[model samples]
Target: MKLPVWKEGLAYPQPSEMSYPGGMTRILAHDGRRDLLPFLHDCTITSHEGRLYLGWYNSTDAEICGSSLIRGRYSEDGGESWSEVFNVVGEIGSAEEHFVPASFFVHEGKLYSLITEMGGKNLSISLDLFQAPETSLDEWERVSVLSGGFLSNSSPIPMDTGDYIAGVWMPLKGDTPAFPAVLISQGADIAKPWRCSFLYDPLAPDAVKIRCPEITLIVQGSAVTAYVRNDEGKHGDLTCGPSFVFTSEDYGESWSKPARMTAMPVGNSKMFAGILSDGRRYLIYNNDQGYFKRGLLCMALSEPGEVEYTKVYKLFEDKAAELDNRVGVWFYPCACEQEGILYIACTLQEPDGVRSAVIARIPVDTI
Candidate 1:
């Protein structure tokens, strides 16, 4: 199906006027300097009861290199202030065993987390589900809520068929070139067999060099739309691709073939999509064409049921002198709405390549 094409990018106002007014920003986790195990990234945020929760991982060297540990923090006052950070998940990732990143979801009024673990005899990746009860927000024990097999960029959302659906990214292995797919949970229980809908085959000979997909899902009424991070750069003319779009009508049982959302610029990074309580659809991403890095974070919104996100916004950038040297690149936004504010948790990739987490609160009415 053909989707509407929106204009490319809306340049930021002079002196970066688009933010701090739209929302307030805060740096949640960071040491005075990049620590011994400095590399940190893949932050996720959500709202439950009346508090905000944030989670991320810190690696020893580069991503998936030495050891990576998952840490978390929370805010009771709507991102105004935060609790002390703690290791909600145990242990650090090693060469023989690895723990990459985590995402959050609320099911049956209870908060749950899905952490992707890349460990096995072959080091094959899988996702394990854990519950963080209301009594213990800072502490979460490793317990089995579901079997692990796929790696998802975000939390799953409840489907109309009394099920749950989430986007999964299968990395490249051997001749496989990395591909995107969706996992629709059977019934209301995610522990049951999930229907995996493979969008494209990574093993295709014509596949690009690398395809690191970060799937973002938005459910409006019965139409489940996916804004995928389609990082197809080569195998064609030299280029960097934008977010891909597709829809699932049968509650994610199946979906249309992925198609690039033209002009929706992005580097190889994660983007987030969700519908506000007021029904406006919003997307948080680094809408630049650069393939490796980005300048700042951006957001685009679509009026209820519109295909194109005409309402675009440039979020605030963390350009502080103390944070290394280069300008701050806010990437990988995971967001959820509470009351009327859209609380987005993201990572600030400093000049040195180490990362830290931050949260930006934006009210819907302000947009």
Candidate 2:
């Protein structure tokens, strides 16, 4: 693999040397002798009606190459032990039709799985929602919305005005470069007919081409801060390098021009950030860069009700970790905070080049 085009110093305190959540449970592993879908990624977590559920897409080898299935597991005893694997979105998907697990959220007393349903219209995708009531996972009913061509990375967040904003991005369409975008709900309803807004004009005269994006938003009153993965390190420097950032003051109605997150070490990877149950802010993403980049997952936090992340912790590393296969890469982390427990689920790559999934359950007080 080629090294990162940009250079930034390693994180101040090394990740491997710090303490991680104790008894981190390995939810499930790919059984070569039994399973058909070997490659899995984009894990999402949410708790509904007294049960905790985690979901991800199990693909063939490359993403969106062939059929992809949304698989998952449930835990009744608060992340202590999880049930055997089961299908969340069992409909078959292919290169033209692919199902990527977006964040799972509950609204109006009903649990919903926001899916990035890709297919048709020459690789078009939309935020597809699904739900299965309390007694069964055998059937999931599809919920309708008034939108298309949008990719959802995280669940919707309620802003100060009772409205919600969900971090999303527009996929590459022709010469247009994909950039960070936002989807805002109207009048406290997270349903269809979203008002979409982009951080930058991708087709502008001086627009810089970027790689794929999964934006994360930090909301405070009328001020909102958004961050996205910088896979193409062509827009930043060693100082405020990597991670692209954008801000809004009127509840995501509009955004400022694209800029790098000031003086932070965040780099080319999908990150999860949100306000904790205790009013503190927490972020989960990979640390370091280059070959071992995604192999090191780290966490950062801020004081209660503060936006600045002053404390950091080394969450996990791909040491000789084995889950039916030697673990190597851990990426695309999605987190959910509930009942004072932070449930972080991520994709785990193995030595054979296939992938698995795991959820790290940590108490808020332990952070």
Clashing pairs in 1: none
lDDT of each: 0.69, 0.70
Residue 250 displacement in candidate 1 (angstroms):
1.8
Instruction: Report the lDDT tens digits of candidate 2 across residue range 247-326.
Output: 78888888776776534567577888878888887778777455235777877777787666666776557753434435
Per-residue lDDT for 90-198 in model 1, tens only? 4654556666678888887877878778753224466777778457555675555354456777889887678787887777666556677787777767655567776
lDDT of 2: 0.70
Residue 249 error for model 2, in Å?
1.7
Candidate 1 local accuracy as lDDT? Answer: 0.69
Kindly report which residue stretches of model 1 are placed more than 4 angstroms away from their true locations once superposed.
1-36, 93-95, 120-123, 133-139, 145-148, 201-210, 234-239, 318-326
Q: Kindly give the number of clashing pairs for every candidate.
A: 0, 0
